[model samples]
Target: MDPTFLSAVQLAALVRGGKIGALELLDHFIGRAERLDSRINAIVVRDFDRARQRARALDNQADKSAPLFGVPATVKESFDVAGLPTTRGHAALKDATVRVSTLPVRRLEAAGAVIFGKTNVPVDLADWQSYNPVYGVTSNPWSTAHTPGGSSGGSAAALAAGLTGFEMGTDIGGSIRVPAHFCGVFGHKPSWGLLPNYGDPATSSAAGTDIACLGPMSRSAADLQAGLEILAGPDPDETALTLNLPAPRATALKGLRAAVWADQAGIAADPETTAAMLALADALEREGAIVSRSARPALDPLDAYHLYLKLLDAAWSGRLTEETLASRRRDLARLKDSDQSADAVMLRMTDVPHRLWLGLNEQRFRLRRAWTAFFREWDVLLCPAFATAALPHRQDGNTWERRITVGGREIAYNDLLFWPGLTGGYHLPATVAPIAATQAGLPLGVQIAGPIHGDRTTIGAAALIEQALGGFKPPPGW
Candidate 1:
């Protein structure tokens, strides 16, 4: 087996046993990166010399039993890495915004993990595909013509290609989960504020500060846990809240009540995706987990998706100029009598008043309360991560309306946001687990959503699911 393809857990064990030096592991991954990264475009900027020096130092250290000690990891370029430029995939800001190495980066460094390089992201970390002028585009390891998903696209691609043990990325919308879904890896978006998002240049905006979350994306659930342990904590600068809670323990998998809401009556999931989720449910059932197929409390996936868009848009509202806001207000004024669609609601959010936003915030709280009550009867949720498998790469972000065929029916392109938006509504924790692959050889992932602040619960269940159904499968041509 290739050492670069070793899981973080395996690498930690190897380091502790002294069977292979941490420096050797770094060298192995670095060499693999040099060989494969050019085709995948996963790594945007690399610092192999610094990583080798640090790995050498870690090899000499006495305390090598840490969970991620000396493991090589990549960070999404949206996060600061000191010497590397934090472009956030925008070419213009390369000189203005310097990468100062945030708390998340520092924590990972403290854990004795070697930083090999930074991954690519969409421009300003806004799109679903990772492509920008700064570092070009990131291609999926499974298929070069498809996107790996963004803004964590590069992180997922790197992990899938065995370029690194694991990686860290920020998620506000579906940034973390979508990439994991597209790239066929494990990614966890912890409960709101579970991890710090401080010090990234992309997060410098006043409004951007409140909505974004930093989390882990890896090839295995264990790697996600390891990365989360290193990144979760209060901001050292006292400007952010602290969440230093211990990891939740799962004594066993038996008798754990889980909800199965693969597709609400309204949304149509692709046959391949629906089948993949059903297969996972069957596997979980055999694992001694009690599964319930119940109506999910009248959950409105489109509504939830729309609400998520509104909330996320508000987070970046400050970036809009007064003239732009006025123009949007004018646009909305002309549509006061028109019916609302998800797209219309998303467009209207730009001109929403403060009072209206306050009311929406209250409604969001009610939604959260409803989800809290719903979780009382369920411990985990198994659903689709996206509407389809990995999509072919398109630079203009205009491919979302191409009407892909599914289950003998055609669906709109942008409809991909609905399933993912379900978890975003209540600010719940979600884990993306790769279940199987499609007939076309593309990977399919299942999304596991849990109650707010119950990140470990979702992640723990995902870990068990991985054990029940064999974990990640390496992509060919890596």
Candidate 2:
């Protein structure tokens, strides 16, 4: 049986029913990756030998009830797989090997997933495009000229190219959702802290950062839900508490209240993206769901954008050297508070004072509360995932000077962070579900934002939308 387009859950069901052995599925995916990954460059590191052994061993078991049992998947390279280098695409760490697996990797393995390889990522997982000196670049399966969206670009590319069954990726600024949008897949950016980041090299600190989250990326919403079930919950050391994700608000689309925000004041989505969101809202209204096009949270878009930039930059400050921080501090001192340019905002937040960070944290909490109150009236908020579809490959090396064209107008590259940061900055749960395709066949998706800890609500809404409008259509020639 061809398992190319099957979801991880479907593959596991087949394995459990004895219709296909775990080893057979592993071999099928490995073969596909070997033959097709050269074009997209998604699967960068192969761990097929041990994965084969584990799959063969699993075939001998009778109880195969694990949600992802026997299914093959690839994880972002930033994640640690034992003995493999967990380089966040850094050339210096290219030969460095990890001694232990990350918590998510262990959890997924325990849930019967056959993780055969690691996917590509940008250097330090910082850019929206996934290209590094270590593993090269990953292209969108829809069109090689366009990127698959990074820092989880390779994971999305692999899934879209039929090279992997499922994937897990980290998201701070649309790393997971943008790729899902660009690749026409389903990706869930779970409620912050829902998934443990124990062993990932980037976030293995004593205290995890507030804005970043690790989540599941897959071709189907059901697979995303299944992956979240296996990966969510308290860390292994925090066994005193268990995670009980609340059930979705409602299973059916009807009776659900959805707020659609297709474009914000300063940010304009592509014409196709705007049309797709409006079309989705119209469809929801036709299906008996109450859709409001003008609804918005109490927070101001500019304030939220500044707050997100501050918190996101502060979260990443640990990576900067003392000299760099000192230089940035000097630069910040020379600038006035009126300077609201992207570089000025980033420089000011590079070395945030403890008290200032506390204030920002309080602001974030207030934003979360606003979202909570908004969700009390609206079950989900549908918005553009990004300003445009999969962007063309841009590798000029100077990211700060780079710009992206949206609706025929060039905007600062950082503007891409607006929509994702809207929910990400506030630590709310958001899911990306493909809604329509651009004129060139590039996929466009909408963000389903829900209340904090309302992960299942967003996923359920995406699933319902997916049911209404089909999800995860393979790219041509894939």
62-132: candidate 2 lDDT, tens digit per residue: 88988899999899999988889987877888787887799999999999999999999988888889999
Best by TM-score: 2
| Residue ranges of candidate 2 with Cα displaced over 4 Å | 200-203, 326-339
TM-score of each: 0.92, 0.97
**Candidate 2 overall Cα lDDT vs. reference?**
0.89
Model 1 alpha-carbon drift over 4 Å, by segment: 95-99, 200-211, 239-250, 321-339, 397-412
Alpha carbon deviation, residue 275, candidate 2 (Å)? 1.3
For candidate 1, write residues 205-302 as lDDT tens digits: 32234446788998888888777777777666655565655355354667777888766665657788888877777877787878886637444656
lDDT for model 1 comes to 0.79
RMSD of each: 2.6, 1.6
Clash count per candidate: 1, 0
